[model samples]
Target: MPANEKLKEKISHLPHKPGIYKFFDDNGIIYVGKAVDIRKRVSSYFNRSAQHNKKTLKLVSQIKDIEFTIVDTEADAFLLENNLIKQYQPKYNILLKDGKTYPYICIVNERFPRVISTRNKKNDGSRYFGPYPSGTTMHVVLDLIRTLYPLRTCTYNLTPENIAAGKFKVCLEYHIGNCKGPCEALVDEAEYNANIAQIKNILSGNLSVAKAYFKEHMAAAAADYQYELAHKFKQKLDMLEDFQAKSTVVSNTLTNIDVFTITSNEQCAFINYLKVMNGSIILTQSLELEKKLDEDDTDILASVIVQLRQEFESTSREVITNIELRLPLDNVTITYPQIGDKKKLLSLSLKNALYLRKEREGRQEKNKEMSEQRELRVLETLKKDLRLTELPRQIECFDNSNFQGDNPVASMVCFKNGKPSKKDYRHYNIKTVVGPNDFESMYEIVTRRYRRLLDENQPLPQLIIIDGGKGQLGMAVKALRDLNIYGKIAVVGIAKRLEEIFYPGDSLPLYIDKKSESLKLIQRLRNEAHRFAITFHRSKRDAGTLKTELTDIKGIGLSTADALLQKFRSVKKLKDLTLDELAAEIGKAKASILYAHLHPAEGENA
Candidate 1:
């Protein structure tokens, strides 16, 4: 059957239910998508009457087969699609490259739970809250918790058996009143757990519960005529109110709503999510997604809503967004407010997204400018050091490589404005030299390089560096003299022993300051030339070895052997690999052929 007919038949049989669908060719999955109606969405790709973009058309043409999973709702489909995309990383999916991990407040799961800030979220039965965007805000909340409840900050095991056996002592934290001496059994477990319960309430944005607990205690202290204790409780209550006042409250009536807004350019989309609880903005997160196709802001926003909400474990009944999104969420209200506080919330979220975009762009621009300025400064310093009439904006360094006078090769590395211009780099095999003649090889390559440049009417480099002492520099100068361009370009040679610089027709070597930028740049050019030459020489030698050994195996071509050598570096290394490891690099069929040839004893058993 034809590939298109096979795909069409598969799409025709899809059920009309909400689910995620995957498009695949012979290699693997290429695209993953979520839709409310699987049959309609899959058939739309094959519908000739509908207008489709070039990318969509290309995707449809390449899809040879289709597979889908039925789900109960669109929300479930979104979740499944997100997970599949992450697992497979299909070629045509909007990549959500998550940023750095934010700090979460963790309540340690132990006999006496300790509250602390952590960046790692492990599933160890411990509770985590507030991947706070602002470290300052998180620290402030931590301080409030510490002042309200004097929990232990130490990591002592604090097991019931250890505490009962008196295996621990009170630390300085207990003396400083930051801890209630839980390690020494001075604080009862039930009372300590009660304080932990209240701390949980405060961290969850339920400050009213904590406040009520403090107020009731204050009243009890006043009834017992303990004025000083009651005064301390009053101070705690006042601190709670002050903290609440500092929070950015949207409105007293609004509760348990999430606001999401999107700002995008041609390449990427930035979405900001704000979680509002009890009329105050409690959490804020911004996500950056790299676009794969021509998806509009509304579609991207809808997908991101599912992603961020699931990550933050948001259970808000209402979702407010800047654009109109028709997600089939059960009993959930999607609002696009026009003229109310909800509108302001949406605007605030949009402002955040725009600010994030502007900040990222501005940072990139500033870094580019700084890099250009630094490069210009380095070039100027190098010009002064070399005493050249013109700045060496283009510098070329050459080095020759050989192993016991075999597989001789030469490499030329170019640096433009004090940075490596890899596109201008070139490698050469020795054509005229017989064996291990560095001087003659240098002369041949130098003459050939400049002769071709002159023949092609290409620009010449301002400075040339030879990676050896006076002998190599003299050969390069002889080559230029033969070409009648000896006085046109400046040439120098560097000695590896002392990093001494040799000029043409000079007897003595010049030494610049050890820490000078000019010296560093010269050293960088010399090292890069040596590395390039050695790499080329090894590749040539490895190719010869593979031709003698690996080519003996049937169905293994030079390209495959070269690829294997480039990765594992040698036949010994490749021989040690399992069949599965080889399959991962090359295909299973080729891997089996090679593995069987390499390990004939093991192959016979199989």
Candidate 2:
């Protein structure tokens, strides 16, 4: 059958039930679409008068084949459509790219396991809590868990050999009462597992039960005359109580659902989702995408449903029934429930979404205005401060750092329109110059960075900023001139004490007008570059320290050190291994003698 005839036959077979349908081209590129009535939705496309937009028209023309899944209801269709779109990443669909899976608190299925944040959510007999908004939030919660439970966070495998060798010792966390020190066998397995169960309860919102258990344990410790243990439990109980007091309370009437609201401007549309779980507002995610509307709200809602379902599929609860949209759901039950907490939650979510949309729009406008004002101010300031010929739109700042001239490094941070262009940030390791010669290092770094830019056919920055006055700027200018790239780039220097700005040709220091936003922005960019350079330098110094310790060994070089560290994970782990094992891991011939020093029981002479 011909492609158009196949699509027509499939459309004829589509049911009147609420569901999602997909259109595929000759190349098998799928375009996902949702509808309240699949028959009506699919049939409308065959009508030329109904085609309102270029995209829709294009979609109609490309429909070589059609397919759909029958849904129980419109709500199910809305959800299932999202899942398919996310899975398929249909070429025509507006995809929301989810970066990393959000962190979730996991209680591992071990006798003395720890509470930790994991991206992977598996049904491995361990209870999981969250899909927390961010890693920082997860870290904060993990810290609180440690404070409350005092469970061992270590991944120390409980093997017979390690136990017999007395290799396990109580860590600082245990000594400080943040952990119960299971590695040293200070706590029995049953007791540890019981603690984990209590933690799971606390995380799952049964805080009252968790608190009662803690209190009972504290009383038992006190009765046994274990004052130290009693005091530790008391502290944990107090912290949990404090946390409960501060957390927001929700009404019992609200159900788990996601409420969506959309607001649009000329250029883009903002779609916000308010995720409510167990009557509490857990998170809000807003997506800004290209606007396309010619008065079909159902079509818009359909598009959003297709887009959003993919986002919520992985971690959100399966009990989601309510989805409040700006548009009517037609045959799908997009309920605007009147009266009760569900209605109130939906109202609040919609209001928040609209407010946020307006706020973001306002901020963008304000930022544009601020950028213009700052640019004019920077021009005036530059004319006065550096006595420049004209206002430089593109200013480049350079800073260098080193350890007593050892492991020298530099970084270039760029600023355009009074904002840092972090994409333009570049790093350099000082290869030619040695020891405390800041000017030479600057010249070399700047030359190399710009030379590569030139080779790549990239435009030169209008202004150059150096960390020091006159001498540094002059050296940079000289290097530029030597490379026949001098006049195209202007050089400025910012000094430490007076925060004075200097130009390449001029000997005197210059200062910007006080409290200028442009000056603040430039300083921030320069400081960021300085920080980047110093951080890189410190990492190099640390690596050098490691090399000094390990590289002298016959088989150990930089690559070998890296391999050992990658395999063992830490210096402590590397130290714990016998020399023969390390040699075997790295395939080194000096294994036997190294084993003698590390494990004298082997009897080979070091």
Relative to the unseen true structure, what is the C-alpha lDDT of residue 510 in candidate 2, on a scale of 0 to 100?
68
Each candidate's lDDT (Cα)?
0.88, 0.71
At residue 22, candidate 1 shows an lDDT of 97
Q: Which portions of model 2 show Cα errors greater than 4 Å?
A: 1-19, 48-51, 62-65, 68-79, 122-125, 159-167, 217-231, 252-284, 289-344, 366-606
Leading candidate by TM-score = 1
| Candidate 1, residue 518: how far the Cα is off, in Å | 1.1
lDDT per residue for candidate 2 within 358-438, as digits (tens), equals 888899999989878967786667655555676667778899897776888999888776667888888888888868899
- How many clashes in each structure? 0, 1
Query: Which regions in candidate 1 have their CA more than 4 angstroms from the true location?
Result: 1-77, 80-131, 134-136, 145-201, 208-237, 262-271, 286-307, 322-336, 482-484, 549-606
Candidate 1 TM-score, true structure as reference? 0.68
In model 2, which range of ten residues has the least summed lDDT? Answer: 313-322
C-alpha lDDT (0 to 100) for residue 207 of candidate 2 = 70
TM-score of 2: 0.51
Which candidate has the highest lDDT of all?
1
Score residue 66 of candidate 1 by CA lDDT: 90
